[model samples]
Target: MKLTSLGIRQKAFAYSMTTLGSSLINSLFSFYYVKLFLNRYRISEGMFHQAQIVFMLWNAFNDPLFGYLQDNAKVPCCAKRHLSILYGAPFYAIAFLLPWFPWRDYQEGDWLCGVQLVIALCAYDGMLTFVLLAQCALFAEISTKHENRLQLIKYNQVASLVGSSSVLFCGLISDNMENIFNFQVFALCVAMLAFGCMYYTGMNCVSQYEHVEKLEKDKMEDASNLSWTSVFYLTKQIVTQKNFLLFIVMNFFQVFHLAFLNNFMLIFADHLIPPYLLPAFVKSIMYGAGFICPQLLILSSQSLLRKLGYYKIILSVFYAELLSATVMLVLGPSHHYVLSMFLVANMVMVSATFSLFNLPLADIIDADLLNYKRSFPLSSMVFGTNALFTKPAQSLAPMLVVTILNQFDYEKLKDNFTHSEQSALQDLHGAMFYLVCLTPICIAVLQILAWTPYSIRDSHTDVAKYIES
Candidate 1:
């Protein structure tokens, strides 16, 4: 548990690899997938939705399966949890390009295209699930002290910021609609970068793995002995807790907010921000600023988090996000369609919320460990099991956004102009309003309601008191 400065930096950089790739892949899917595949490649809207649905189904089994595997992995080696990332990282990098490439031309409404889409989603997301589940579980397992965990999480966030900002660099490539191929090449490079970072982390970060291996050896309970049915039963037992269930609900809505912005921000910019003010590179710059500013705010507000506790701070974040979304919807169109500034504010709020949103979950896990007498595997179970709910929100958001846009004749707007674009543009405007404002406002309200009754902060305090006594 004694982490030197060098170890801390090394571990942070290692984990950053995961976030770098994760952010790149996630940004590509969230920001560019619909634009590239559906808009440029002529992939049908129906096909895009189908691929997401299929991926959701794949995640239903894949997340928990890996969660169980990591929790109960009986590897008499360095770290049972690290095994997934060690093996899965390469596939994670390679599979990301599958959906971007096809043997034949992608035709709208083509069943073959739909089938290819499903296969690609499965391949890419399956490897993603394997690596990410382990990385997430490590957040708890890597450090036991609260302050140390916070430091590590801070490092993790720095990596996340850098990874998310990678999308901005893509603007350096051709942003022209005709340069979709160039965009795909950039995506390929990002994938390789993701793999390289992960590979180094997996190879060099052996200390934590060794520590976890020792803990597993000394543990009394062995989940590996249980049947598959017990997996469901155990997951049900954990999720059925009032505090854990509420956390899951709050996290879901929070992710929905993130997914909305990530998935729709580009399209929203296209409709809301005038081309004269926020060109493609400028939009990327704004997006990067949006992500970075909140991190800086959160870092400066560490004092606020200490004094106010996570509950109040989180409530403030929700309200701040709601207000920002409302302001954007009302005044976004008024400023000559140059609303990139407001987008930065919106990003800051979202980034702040997301950056610290999971602090409670980590505390909740600590409380569970104190009460239930478990160890690192418990972290795996909590984070891994929650993905069943959280992943749905993440997957569903893009589909929902695209579906809404499609209703507004979004596909027609993407195609070569043969008729008046005025009607479609107006519909796009309406869709952007709802996505940026109404949908988030509603989600924020739900998160507030769910978060209000949460007393995990009290639970964490109670555990701290017991330790002191």
Candidate 2:
């Protein structure tokens, strides 16, 4: 379907609502879940960790399954790819509230607490994968024209920024108030907001785009007739594609870099504005500044993106990451504003690089389609597997921080820790320096190396022209 400008804006807005909702849901859990579970409820480290492992493994296994199901699902009055979102949105929002509402009857770290955590998390992850994969698949489903996809992607990025910023409420609450009831109320409110957005997007926004062509019944029967060995063969075929493989590696590094920053941001914050001095609302400001700057930078850099193209943009942002990290390292835990700027710079570089790399992902899918000569939608499979590759990096990031801190004998700052204790504070600062600066630089460099040989330009452009024609 050829979309008018208004149609484009409406579709983009609908698609972005999904991004906004998911981002809010993710930011809330990613930043606060551990603190609430461990400190507030006093869940045992062992039990909580076990649940984390289960969540990871389950997602690793099921993400592709849901992807495949979305690719093949049949339903009346719904897009094949949108079916999951339509059916799964309500379940997803309900599952999101699971971790926050633990069984009060169970004592802290009780076997029941662990069981509840695992079950809740598993359900949450399953529904999350279902809802998100469908939303993500829309990137490929909604439009293949370069400019149209770009418009959708840009809107998605803006929504993502808004969603990430929404978590500032937690920081504000933490800094300005002290009441469990307030926190619970905030959680409930956000949960409903997330659900409403996701439901609206799935029900209404999905129809704005042309749905993928469903395989006829005879074709479905023929596909089913293929031997099960075809599955392994197809998997091998995808993993072996040089461009796709490199994209997967780049995706992993991108996620790993972000994960490292998030895992250690608390320590990084300590180096800049210790919690004793950092009010929650001020910390929220710092986070908001850091989070929003990148999107702004990205929006401004669009002209540059047009000029530099994908590879050059990757190089530019990767080097920027290295430079920002180095400057932050040199600043070495000093003035709050200066430190915040450098931290934000590092984030800008990180987010900018991530966004730049994502611009090529759709192209990579195009390349796959052209090379393989497949006609049906493969966005779900491509993105599904990409999501699979990033799982380990997400799973490993927290553990990486813990291992590094343990190795350095880093002490966690308490409310009672005095400025007079320069030794422990310095040690903590040193850890943050490596985590934010040196390690990320190394990852970025490696990603640069992986991306150097990727030559998707000609093929991607050809696909774009062909699709437009």
- Tens digit of lDDT per residue, candidate 1, span 273-336? 6677766776667766766676677777766665666788888888877877687678756674
Candidate whose lDDT is highest: 1
Q: Report, for every candidate in turn, its global Cα lDDT versus the true structure.
A: 0.70, 0.67
State TM-scores per candidate: 0.89, 0.87
lDDT tens per residue, model 2, 235-305: 56677889888888877888877766654565467555666676666777776665666667777766665
Clashing pairs in 2: none
Error of 1 at 123 (Å): 2.0
* Residue pairs in candidate 1 whose N, alpha carbon or C atoms collide under 3 angstroms: none
- Poorly placed runs, candidate 2 (over 4 Å): 43-45, 75-79, 105-117, 174-178, 206-223, 275-278, 356-358, 407-425, 458-469
How well does candidate 2 score on lDDT at residue 280? Answer: 64
